[model samples]
Target: MSIEANLEKIERLTSKVWRSYSKEDPLGHLSFNEYDYLKAIQAARVPIRLTDLAKELEVTKPSATNMVKRLERKGLVLRVSCSEDARSKRVMLTEKARAPLESESEIYTIIAQKLKVHLSEQEFDALNTLLTKALR
Candidate 1:
């Protein structure tokens, strides 16, 4: 197949895989974007400034602010004045948010197992390596 044809095939399959998990309620309380932001906040290890979060997510400052507001309303995240610069605000995940974030790891493990069903061990490992490299 031509490269274009192969790429289109990969896109279609990727869409299908995303759809398989997109509508599920593994995270019943939070939308995917909210959960994603929470995951990012947790991974940061330190409270992150709103501007930095926007940069990390490649979103506008206003967009990131809106998302953080929504998360605050849901009690999943907290925004506090930056200690170093009191005028600026930082965002962090709450203890309550950790439970759902932990659940996501389990959910992904299940998803990974299902995805691997069609491939042999070698094929699965190769796919993992190739996709990781491509992402980088």
Candidate 2:
């Protein structure tokens, strides 16, 4: 009933929603760190530097490098020399990662559709706006 109580409830529900979304994908069996790396590469669209990936994931450089290496070995990602900086390497998603990303997107679409069954269009729009504002 109180503002704090409402906020807490929202946070809990949002976390559950995210977990549900994550689990819905058969290909999302990847660890959270791996999924984060894949998502970042998908979003970057360009060769992303290891330092930048580390910063984006809020992890250390060595941790990012290790993760990239794992993805590279799995054939999900490739490490390429940065054109702008000869000494630096960039991570790029390989075609192997694309199918998994697409599967995750489909999972989210199904989750969204299920949620829409419970929420009115206006309520969903307001929730989206609130989440965008919170991120900012």
Off by over 4 Å in 1: 1-26
Candidate 1 residues 1-136, lDDT tens each?
A: 8978977876676666556665654456667688778878988989999999999888899999999999898788899999899889999888778776665665466556866998999999998999799988
Model 2: residues >4 Å from true position, as ranges? 1-29
lDDT of 2 by residue, 1-136 (tens): 9979977876676666668766655445679779889998888878899999999989999999999999898889999999899999999988878776866665566656766788999998887898799888
Candidate with the greatest lDDT versus the true structure: 2
lDDT of 2: 0.82
Worst 10 residues of 2 by lDDT: 20-29
Each candidate structure's TM-score, on Cα atoms with residue i matched to residue i, is 0.71, 0.77
Q: What is the lDDT of residue 103 in candidate 2?
A: 65
Report lDDT (Cα) of residue 47, candidate 2: 82
